[model samples]
Target chain A: MNPLLRVEKLEVVYGRAITSIQGISLEAHKGEIVALLGTNGAGKSTTLRAISGFLGLDDARVTEGAIHFKDNSLANRPPYLITKLGIVLVPERDKVFPNLSVVENLSAPVATAGANRKRLEEMAFTFFPKLAELRGRTAGLLSGGERQMLALASALVCGPELLLVDELSLGLAPVVVEDLAQRLVEIRDKLGITILLVEQNATVALSIADRGYVLENGRVVLDGDAARLKSHGDIQEFYLGGAGERRSYRDVKQYRRSRRWYG
Target chain B: MQLAINIAVLTAIYALIACGYVLIYRVSRVLNLAHGELMMLSAYLLITTASLFSKTPFIALGAAIFLSLCVGVLVYLFLMRRMTGEMVLAAVLTTVALGVLLRGLVVLIWSAQQQNPAQALGWVNHSLPVFGGRISAAGAALIATTALVYVGLFLFLRFSRYGIRMRAAGQNPLLAAQRGISLHVIYALAWGLSTLTGALAGILISLDSGLDSTMVLIGLKAFPAALVGGLDSLVGALLGSLIIAAAEVLMIYYVDALLSDVVPFLVLILMLVFRPWGLFGTREELDRV
Candidate 1:
């Protein structure tokens, strides 16, 4: 069977000069959580933005390659069309409408075709009951953790087949991030929704993602099963921060020179 | 008593027209400088339709109002739609140019003559007594229409799904679009509603007094009320109209008759200096523009 989303050799350019991302490839099958882990400016967000059709606002475009969702090419499509086609994005920032009340924010997104809006809303509330309590509160007044929950819940309200979440644990407490990560797993298991999670928190992402890809400077350097990645030597030294021995700066430079020779 | 009545009548005029500016500005952040010309055009539409359906005055009014709604939508779809993704100042200047073009067209088509639709429709502007002050029939209608329009708008925006979507679009267009709301449709609807309200104000005013180029000045004066109230807040528009109307009426009575035309703007400048966002407007709104 084909995967739900297939992105092959995707290249994105900003303002015709700067190439934000190039030749990045990934795929997500139905009912799986795939994590794209990277630090700032690693092009994780750009990949997600390309998939979700949000690059237009910044005058960026998917200049090369293709994003195929359920065998349909999604190139140069508007954000609303991309959303309506069942790929919903929970953006990195400004995820919820600040001025609107929680209920209004949830009500604002158009549900997927043939999906029951009220049922989806109820499903969202079921996943995060805290949102039910803060139904009347303005979204701007919510704390960082609560806002993240609201953002996740509102994304669910769109009834998407593929959910693209950018920076799920950003500006969030560790405990809150852990809980949200767990809830995300629960949501995928219960709703059978495919998820592409972009995150700087590699540990949290790997904990929930079935598969993982590590990005650096817009290129995918390594990818493998989550458990294998967790135990890998490079991941241990860099992402997991479990580098056992303290090496000198000269030793690090020597290691980098050897890495380029083989990498 | 007379002073109070004058204030009420002037308040009705300003509030009625001011909501038009608020409606368009709030949704799209484009100030329709041609609103005065558009308002005048609607009155002229009323004249043509009234003559066509002279026996059925209500039908003529309805047809004219409906045509004005179409005009507003077409204006956005054909002209202002091109201005989307451009700078805010450019869009505003386009409206100014549209107003100029429309003014020349109105004179060319309708011939700059002072005419009364009520006379053609065979209706008298009867003076009626209310609370010890006399009110003309059209003046009373203007007050009632303004009150009804405000209440209807308040209810529509607060409770309706489309209204919530409109507010959503106004706050964040990118987010709104991502959520599956069409920005073009929302913007077009705003333009239609704004022109519809302005048309109503124009139609009623022309029926009260004779229609001429001077009607454009009344439309222009009402803009300060919208600004004073906060360009985005409907409730602010209402309150701002009352404040400016009171100032203008009082100034004309005691200070100078010529002061009436300038008082609303003087109040607008004061509001700008003290509270650029207006009374009920969000402070962050000042930076968005």
Candidate 2:
């Protein structure tokens, strides 16, 4: 019944004048997937970085409020300590140690957490059978989809109670995203691991997420059940670029152009 | 046969110093350019302590090692920690200054005089026939001590938890910290171990010839050894040391004696050109720089 993770008024600032996230509050309950949807510069990744403690205190700090994981205050905790507390973040960059083999990459998180190494490997393999086959290969050689799988698998190997995934469907083919979405559902159902997924792909995320929060300009603009948010006119207007007409060709073209400019 | 014995003795000494350099560099990724100076400091400490305790050479040696470890820890906490920044040049310069300071301090303490502790140990300078040549007691001890140190380090690295943590810290400090391995503790341990090896090698070399400020230059020989062996590979250090020592000795005999001074540097350059990662280091390691 209790929430697995809670973030209350979490505000992050980049510099003296630049505020990334103004005031964001969110929660993830036990055995539920919560997707954080936002446009570019919506402070989604920054929020995750702040919660995970990867951002150094000087360069990036939570200017106000607190983040609690399973009732423990994680506002000022170091990144390693946060990891030790069982909230594992699979960062957006797929920051796998390239020289290390897939097995080594998987083992690193587990080893750092001091988990049961054998059980971790077994559980990771169960979720990603492809990883088991490519265990000997270096993570550098893996495809984007495969790398995402490895990244997810590596985090799960820690046996984390809550998994914070940043942009899981980023840069993947449509079919690959579908495959990952299915796996995410199966993982939640089978392992009972809570997930907080930050995504730019609203449709894919909403399809799997139990509940969703639509963020715009660092503030939560909409929050409700996934089905309700998908049908909400405002949500469709902001994220999908329109309510009906299946997203105009001109709009899609403009979106792609903007993506290239930003990217 | 005399030639073989000399080569073996020289190889063992080179290997000992190379191990010290490699250990520090592998973990810290800093060249520790003043490492040779640390060795010089330890040798002077041993010489001074030996003079005071004229009746106990072994006691003096033990005390010297302990003192060197303390000095190493002190250097890490006070000097190395403060030298951290984006510019490695600043760190390298700091080490250079420390080396100069150590060398000057040695001169102030011991003067420019060359001192020998062989008499303090009451070991007569006599050579026994081995491999159709005479092998002195000092040569035998040097080889024996080198072998003991190498084997001890091997066992410690393979079996000890601290040693494993040290290796892990070297490979990935962030990952090591995530696992609760303290970086400060590992760095101190690394410096202590390296200083011990360096000091022991310096003392042994001093015994072979005599202790003087110039003995510090012997630490430079380790640079080539580390390069050839792969900065991260202990076995590479040994192999590289042997190769450098053999080349130097052979050059002194067959080539011009004057060219021996340049052999190690030449070998380092050639190795860098052919295998920049050294013989044992991974290519990925080069990308880190």
Candidate 3:
């Protein structure tokens, strides 16, 4: 089966000077949950932005390589057109229209051309029932977890074939992150939609993701089954807090340095 | 009694024009300082159209309004479109320049003399008595048009799909685009609507008092009303217009006749000093402006 999204040697540059995403390649097959793991400025979000439409940085652009969604090339396309092509993004921040009511937020997205907006909105409410109850409440007044749920639901309301979530676990409790991660799995399984999740937390990401890629300094250094990545020494040491703390700082630094050298 | 009628008519005029300011600002966060000039231009269009459709006055009026809408869209496509990704200050200054250019263009095209659409259309600005006060037919129409426009806008922004999308675009444009809402279309729609309403104000005011370059001053005066109400809030604009209109008219009655032109700005200064966001506007919106 063909992958729903394919990024080949993608490179993003910011302000025409800084290279945010050096050559990077990744893919997400239909109905699979893929996690993009990285530290701050690892180009995880930049890669996601390139795939969805364009970088947030005003002068930033996909300077090299291409992104293919189905048969369509997503380069330089407007965000709304990208969305109409069925790739919806849940941005890292400012995801929901703060002043809008929960219902207004749900109803506002421009779903795929042929998709039934009513059904999508209902689907959103079903996935996040808490949103249905808070239909009249302002989005800004919602708690962080609630806001994340609304953000996801609204993205779903767009009837996306591929959902790109940036920093799904950012500023949220571990329990909440885990719960949302499970929801991501259910959404994929039930809707048969592909999900490319960009996250800093590897544990929650790997817990539900079918496959994962580790990006550092704009390069994809590791791509494998989620379980395999969980056991990888570098991932375990830097991402999962390591097996035991007694091992020490000198060895960990050497391990990181060696990993960077190989990368 | 005449004082109340005068205040109501002035409030309606200011309210109608103020929404034009609010509509454009709420969507793009750019103040179209050229709004007054655009309004005056629309009234002038009525003069040309009146002659074009000499036998049918209503057709001339309709054609003029339609032309105003097109001019608005054309302005966005040709001028404001370039400034979309640029700084807000740049866009505003461009509007300032556009205003000056348009003022010159209006004078060159329509000339600086007082032109009468009412006479051109073979119509009369009849003064009718109401509540023991008399109001010109055009004044009554202004109030009615203002009411209709606000109600239409309120309904459009609340429940309609495009309206919701427009609101979504206004609150967070990036998120709106991510949600598949086109910011360009929304911004263009705003400019079109803003100018449409401005046209109504200009056309009606010209019909009431005849038209000339001085109509721009009415457009400028309405700015304080929009500022006082809150630039982004329709409700704010409505209340703000009432406040500014009341102060301007009452000052003319109780204070000095010379204060009519200065009262709106005087009230504006106080509102700015006390509540910069206006009565109904969002506080953070001021920072963006």
TM-score chain B for all models.
Answer: 0.97, 0.94, 0.98
Superposition-based RMSD of candidate 3 using all C-alpha atoms, in angstroms: 1.7
Per-residue alpha-carbon lDDT of model 2 for B123-158, expressed as tens digits? 466677886898877788889989999999988875
Error of 1 at A77 (Å): 1.3
Estimated TM-score per prediction?
0.96, 0.77, 0.97
Descending-lDDT candidate ranking: 3, 1, 2
Q: Which stretches of candidate 3 lie over 4 Å from their true place?
A: A55-57, A248-253, A256-263
Better of 2 and 3 by TM-score: 3
Could you tell me which residue pairs clash in candidate 3?
Answer: none
> Which pairs clash in the backbone of model 1?
none
After superposition, the stretches of candidate 1 with alpha carbons farther than 4 Å from their true spots are: A256-263
Compute DockQ for each candidate against the true complex: 0.58, 0.18, 0.68
Find the candidate with the highest DockQ and give its number. 3
Q: Write the per-residue lDDT of candidate 1 for residues A1-263, one digit (tens) a residue.
A: 89899888898999889999878888899999999987799899999989888523468889998999996899778788888899988888888889889998888888888999999999999999999999999999999999999888888888899999999989888999999999999999999999999988889999999998888788788888999989988888888889888988777765531121101
Q: For residues B192-255, could you state the per-residue lDDT of candidate 3 as single tens digits?
A: 9999999999999999999999999999999999999889989999999999999988888898
Q: Report each candidate's C-alpha RMSD, comma-separated, in the order given.
A: 2.2, 5.4, 1.7
Which pairs clash in model 2? B229-B236
Ordered by DockQ, highest first, the candidates read 3, 1, 2
Q: After superposition, how far is residue B73 of candidate 2 from its true place, in Å?
A: 4.0
Whole-model lDDT for model 1 versus the true structure? 0.88
